[model samples]
Target: MSTEKPRPTFQMDGHDVPFDEGQSILAAALAAGRYVPYLCYHPEFQPHGSCKVCTVKINGRTHASCTTPAHEGDVVESNVDELNDMRKGLVQFLFTEGNHFCPSCEASGNCTLQAVGYDLGMTSAHYSPLFPDRPLDASHPEVLLDFNRCILCELCVRASALVDKKSVFSLAGRGIQKHLVVNAESGKLADTELSVDDKAMSVCPVGVILRKRRGFQVPIGERKYDEHPIREVAVQKQKGE
Candidate 1:
C-alpha cells in the first residue's frame, strides 16, 4: 500500500472555500483564522448540530458550520447582527429549558454555554422555565450527572459515541420532558465504560455532566475564561493550530 499523505486545502471568506476530501467548513475557516461560534462540536468528536448556535450565512442562507461542507465560490459570513440575535435567542431557549443558575454552578465561571451566552449578550431569559424535575446521578465515582442543568446540546452524547466509541449517553423522551440517560441498566453512570478521561464530561457546555473530583481545579482567575474569549478558543481548537 502507498504511504503518501494528502495535502490541505485553503479558502478565503469571500471566495468559495475549496474543501478537501474530508475537511469541514469549520475546520477550514478556523485554519484561516475565521471566527465561528460553536458548541456541541469539538474536533476530538464527531459534529453534532443540536446546539444550533453555530449558524452562519453561506451564500445568503443560514447553515450550521459544524455540518456544512466548504465548497468553492461559497461566500461564508460568520458575523451578522441577525445571526447573532438568532444565536442569542436559541441560547435563551436553552437557559429557560433548564436550571442554569450561574452563581451556584460548578461550571459557572468556566462553562462554554455560559460563556457563549455572555458573548451573545443573553443576559436574561425571556421564555418561561420548563423546571423539569431531574434526578442527579452521583453513582459514578469520577463524574456527576445533574440533568437539570443540561441544555440537551448533545456534546456529551457525541463525545461518548465518537471519542469513547462506547455510546454511553443518549436523550430519551421528547420536547419538555426530554432528558439525558446513561447506557447502564441502572441508568447510573457508575458501571459504564465512561471515566474521568472521557471527553463526554469535559465537553458538556453546561453544569449537567461534570467531573466529580475536579471542580474548580484551576481556580477562578486561572480558567480558560480568564485567558481569552470562547470564540477565539473555539477557532484555535477547531483549527488544531
Candidate 2:
C-alpha cells in the first residue's frame, strides 16, 4: 500500500491547479500551464515582487502573485479584464518612465518589458514621458550600461550578490530618484569585478546591459519574442519547450 499525500490544489479562474509545498501562486500557475505575466519574478531566484506585473486577485483581494504563497482551496482570479487593465496601466507607466526606443535598442525583440507591453495590448504609453537625465556607462572594456532603459527590476543586483558572489550592482536613492548603481569606489563598471559571462550580465530583462560589440547580431524579426507572444514563450520556456 503506497500512502502518499496528493499535491495541494487551488482554484484559479475555475481551474484546479496543484502546487508543491512552498510554491507561490505565480509559480504554481506557471507550472500548471497558466500564464501570469511578470517582469522581476525569475524562477531561479527568490521572489522579488517589485514589478507587480503578476498581480492577481486572491479571495477577492488584490495581491502580487509572485510573493503570495499558494494555499489549497483558495480562490485566485487571473486573466480577468479588471486585473489586465491594471496590468496594462502598469506597463504603460514603465514605458513612459523609461527611454525605451524599441527600434534602436539591441534587446528590442528579446526585452521582457517590451514583450509584456505587447502582451497587454499596449498601443501607447498613456502617461507623458519622463525623459529623465540618466547617464550611459561604457567604462567597461566589454560591457555597456545604459541607464536609460533600466526598469529598476533589480534582477542583475540579485544575481550578482547571490549567484556571482561579487555584489556588483545595487540600487540607490528613494522613490522617483531611485536608480541602479555599480559597486565600485570609483563608481564605474571597469572598477568592478563584473565579467561579460557573469549571471548578472545575462539576467537583465532590458537593454540596460549589453555586450560591447554584440549589437543586433540576430536581427530584429528573428529574435526570441519576435514571432511568439511573451505569454506563449514564457510558459513554453517554463515547460522546457
Please tell me which predicted candidate would have the highest TM-score against the true structure.
Answer: 2
* Residues 1-241 of candidate 1: C-alpha lDDT, one tens digit per residue: 1248544443444543435656677777766667677767776666777777888877778888888877655677776788889988988888888887777778876788888887887779899887767779999887788888887878788888877898999989987778889998888788798977777767787788787777778777677766887878766765664
Candidate 2 residues lying further than 4 Å off, grouped into runs, are 1-4
lDDT of 2 at 24: 98
The estimated TM-scores of all candidates read 0.86, 0.97
**What's the number of clashes in each of the models?**
2, 0
Considering summed lDDT, which 10 consecutive residues are worst modelled in model 1? 1-10
Give the alpha carbon lDDT tens digit for every residue of 1-241 in model 2: 1249778899999999999878899989998889999999999999999899999999999999999999989999999999999999998988888888888899999999999998889999988899988889999999999999998999999999999999999999998888999999999999999998899999999999999989978998999898999889988887888
- For candidate 2, the lDDT comes to 0.93
Residue runs of model 1 more than 4 Å from their true location after superposition: 1-21, 239-241
